[model samples]
Target: MAAAKIKKGDSVVVRSGKDKGRTGTVLQVMPKEGKVVVSGVNIAARHRKPTQVNPQGGIDRREAPLAISKIGLAVDGKPSRVRFETKDGKKVRVAVKSGETIDG
Candidate 1:
């Protein structure tokens, strides 16, 4: 997979869709699909059958994967675009809005 602009654990904001303006932490990144699963965003209900873990399986709510283009990285407590830059011999993500280094 190509290098990911956003990584797991990074805070992000939804730009569009039903969850627009909502913010959440990155839970998983699917580079191949260009999608991400953020906490508390794009939630969906899934019906489950009885299993060893839960005999009374019913409906379960969980976050669903969203297109990466629909979200932006949160920097300085706000949503902003990100760019890659070389800093001290290492590559890092930088926030365009605040000109701040995203990954420390």
Candidate 2:
């Protein structure tokens, strides 16, 4: 497993891919796979097989996992690199671009 800078609820912007430049919230993180699923990004359709949730079993559209390297964390409304820093004796994530604390 690897450490992931992006976590659920964090805002991010796609750096490269079909979704490039699009900003969305991080819905899930897969550090083991180096992938992260962003809401409203990398959408794909899956054909259902008539499950209880939907008897009709129509196609379902959902966000797909994107390579962790393909996205950048959004801080201060801009995409930026993330770094850890100690503030008031507590470690937190900091945005390299804006020098702002992202998480406490």
lDDT of 1 by residue, 42-86 (tens): 999999999999999999999999999999998766789889999
lDDT of each: 0.92, 0.89
Model 2 scores worst on lDDT over the 10 consecutive residues at 1-10
Q: Per-residue error at 68 for model 2, in Å?
A: 1.0
Question: Which pairs of residues collide in candidate 2?
Answer: none
Best candidate (score: TM-score): 1
Write the residue-wise lDDT of candidate 2 on 3-36 in tens digits: 5778999999999989899999998899988999
Report residue 59 deviation for candidate 2 (angstroms).
Answer: 1.0
- TM-score, candidate number 1: 0.88
> lDDT of candidate 2?
0.89
